[model samples]
Target: MTAGVQATVNDASGDPLGAHVALVIVVVMVFWAFLVAGLMFEPYRQFGHTGRLLQLTGICHLLTVLQDSRSWSLARVGDVASILMLGLLAHLILTLPQGRIISGRRRAAVAGMYAGVVAATAVSLRYGPGFDAGCDCFPPGPELSAAAQRGLLYGSAAFFWAYGLILGGVLIWRLLIRPHPAQRRSFSLAALTGALTIVGVGGRLGLFVMPGTPAPDGPYAVVYAATLTTMVLGPLGLVTVVVRARMHQASILDATVGDQGLLPPSELENALATVLKDPTVRLTGHPPVEPGRSGVPLRIAGDHVVHLTYSSALDGQPELIRSAAALARLTLRDDHLRAELADNLEAVRASRARIVQAGDAERRRIERDLHDGAQQRLVSLAARLGLALLQLSRGQHATATATVTAAVGELQDALEELRELTRGLHSPVLENAGLAQALASLAERSPIPASVMATGERLAPAVERAAYFVAAEAVTNAIKHSQAQRITITAEIRNARLVLTIQDDGIGGARATGSGLSGLADRVAALDGRLTVTSPPGRGTALVAELPSPPHDLR
Candidate 1:
């Protein structure tokens, strides 16, 4: 009997160390598991608030686990902190993917949830039973009447149960209301994990409040297993999301860079949308400034080429977005260049058509002028000469001399009219002399009091022609329509480009789209120049034309 008792005492003494070691190992394993989750989440912190919140949730879970350690004296602190952490978890659920409390109502709801948790914790710590009847792990609560304690416990349990139900319902609603199939797919696993966690915790709390519940040994094992499973699945779910995001990023890169030919803007947008699972994705040449929209600029060689805009729901996947942008930089840049080239070619075609049409109209005008003025005068001169010949043959000397003199006068007038018409077709002064001489001659002919200022630089024929026409058209318009007393024409070479300005002090309601000005604009644009007309009502009109003038040798 004595030997048996001694053996029993030795056995009992050895078991405590083994149990303590086992507990330490369990704690170490939990700590390592949470640590791994934290490390996994660390890389995503730069992406957005979602990653940071996930890390925070993992830390809170670790702390909650520590609170159950008998060796750690953290029960009193854990009681309040753990409940608050759970409230944070609830908040995290509602703001999944983005992890932003987007609305005042949602912020208020989260605040109220924390407030309820605090109130419940106060009641549970004060009047409610502190010691679990099943596990007997906690110390006894303060002395209270049975009725008060029971009522408080039931109230706290009811509040927690409502919290769980509301969170679950919210998860379901989020799943139901998600408009995008991609969003639903991305949110499903996390939401399911969160729902399971709520169920496990609510089940344990429900069992805790029951009367005459047995120890947490037999029937309660399943609930414990479920709670533990939920804890493990929570971190796993987060890891899965991150992994999936990385995979999506890889796919985005492939879709953007794999194509041999440049994708059109529409096709590029479609490709990104399909890969990212966002139907709201689009490409724009300008920044997105709309509410609830986010933009990622695709740049090449430090120049912004285009912007990628999408719904704010995808804010959580910043790395994925950035990777796609990086890969698409060259492609988007090429596409932008191609689009610009297409626009320029179209403009060139339209300008050429307009020029051809203008040439045709000018030819028709020349034909009409010849038939009406020079040709009619020549025919009249022919008849007058025939009359003079008839007089000479009849030996009427004075009559014949008068007829001949009249014919000479008519012939001189017809030649002068033809000279004027030829000058109208192409100015001799402009073709022979430089732009300065051209402008001077133009100013001298203007109906209004006009002045000319030019640098007297010889330019390419095309440049000289454009400049001359711009000045002539401006002077004519000022005379005909502006009713101005004075007109100014200034041309100078700045940065190897001709900057011409035509200013008039007149009624300044001139529009760039007016027939004369529009034609002049097209002429200027044909030389890769810009024409700006600033004619505010009641202000003087200023028509400025900037045209490229390459070096003399280059031209």
Candidate 2:
């Protein structure tokens, strides 16, 4: 050991080996603290960094192997081993939690610098004029360039070994410091996992630094076993705790949503309770439900078409959406109601289909009647009037002239009336143009300011026609019943369903009586689609209708 280090150690420098060992232990302990923390907190990059550290640790182990089998020809090999140990120590300390964690371009630049320094030093150990004996930290050895080998050996031994013991001890004590809440059956899993992850790292590092030296000579084997156990079990313990916590949460959620097939009694109560995280959901109604049976019921004002809704915590939103759907489906389940709706739907189809065919046939008949009957007679009458006017022009009497002029005026009036009648028979423009142009004409003829917007992919012709009719009826109602000043129609396709909305600023008490809205509701129902009206008191009105992508039966 060097007399200078011995003298620096508090006057009584009798045992130089012990003092050197103390210094080695302190340095490695500080470095290990940061590395373990990085492993836990930064986890991903830190674990990646840990993998490199592990490789470095393995490198240190391999170096110890070479240092054991020292040779005369490979005399410079010990300096190479010492340099590798320096790199490994840097590996552990550099990625420690306290160390700056960096990534991407910045990390790459730093890594390149770190590599250059190591490469330069490694090249020097083989070629440059440098210390060539042993690990610079411990055991005074043969002088290469006049430095004691024991001075390096005893110092590294004192520093790294003592530091490893203290680090392991502190972490083990920390594990014993706090007991978990003990509230869950899974608390033991947490306690064991969290403690071991910390203690394992401490122990594993101790084994690496303390062994293969004169000081830890006999105690090395025992410490290594304990440290190794802590290292192996740490991850397993942590995973066990996490898995248990997840399982507990899943069980609680299953109990809340519904235990399989049971339907709830009161939707609103469960919704309110679930929001509050009240242990059990409370359904509305008397006869108090039991065994987690709260649910929403869907039924009509009268009839056995009743069903209750219980749902998984998925798909539908606002909790009550499932209830609303259930009610709609329930309304359709009554034998009589279903039959009536089916008949109503069939009637609508039959009526509109027949009306279209009848209107076309009637249009042809009216055109033929105008040409063959009224138009022919008017043409003959015009010929007769022309002949009489010609007579008057060729010097007829005054009384005859007056009579011909009056007769010509009466023919003109009759022709005007016939033209108005033909226009009313059925609009030719409505048949020639598609629904949008027809609606534009209809809107131009309206009292209110109405507008329509269509976006997204367009719908099938029949669906567009139904939507057009609905908009027209809504505009008409806005003017007649609701006293609305302005109305807007919006149509779009979202996720294969066609959505049509009619919104109006009007006095808001509109009901689905036998008028066109009721017809629209029946029409949508016939398509196996849905119709909803939100006309809140004093809040104006909105009518929403959704139809399937393929509304009409393909057959």
Using lDDT as the measure, the top candidate is 1
Candidate 1's displacement at residue 511, Å, is 15
Error of 2 at 325 (Å): 29
TM-score of 1: 0.56
Cα distance off (Å), candidate 2, residue 412: 21
Could you estimate the TM-score for every candidate? Answer: 0.56, 0.38
TM-score of candidate 2 versus the correct structure, residues matched by position: 0.38
Shift in Å, residue 169, candidate 1: 4.1
lDDT of 2: 0.49
Instruction: Give a tens-digit lDDT track for model 2, residues 1-555.
Output: 132223234223455456445434432433353344324433333124543454444344344324333474344464455455544444433333223345465455346435643554443332232223233333454444323333333344343443334433432332233322212233344335434433433343333333233233234323433443433343343334335534534543443344442223333345334432333433322322444333444444464334333332211122233433343344334434657789988877875775566557657878887787677767767776787777777777675676577667767766775764554443444456644565566567678887867653445656656666666667767778777888887777666677888888888877755445666676676666788888887778899988776533211
lDDT of 1 by residue, 245-330 (tens): 67787787677655476555557778888898878888787888989889987765456557888887666566777776765676
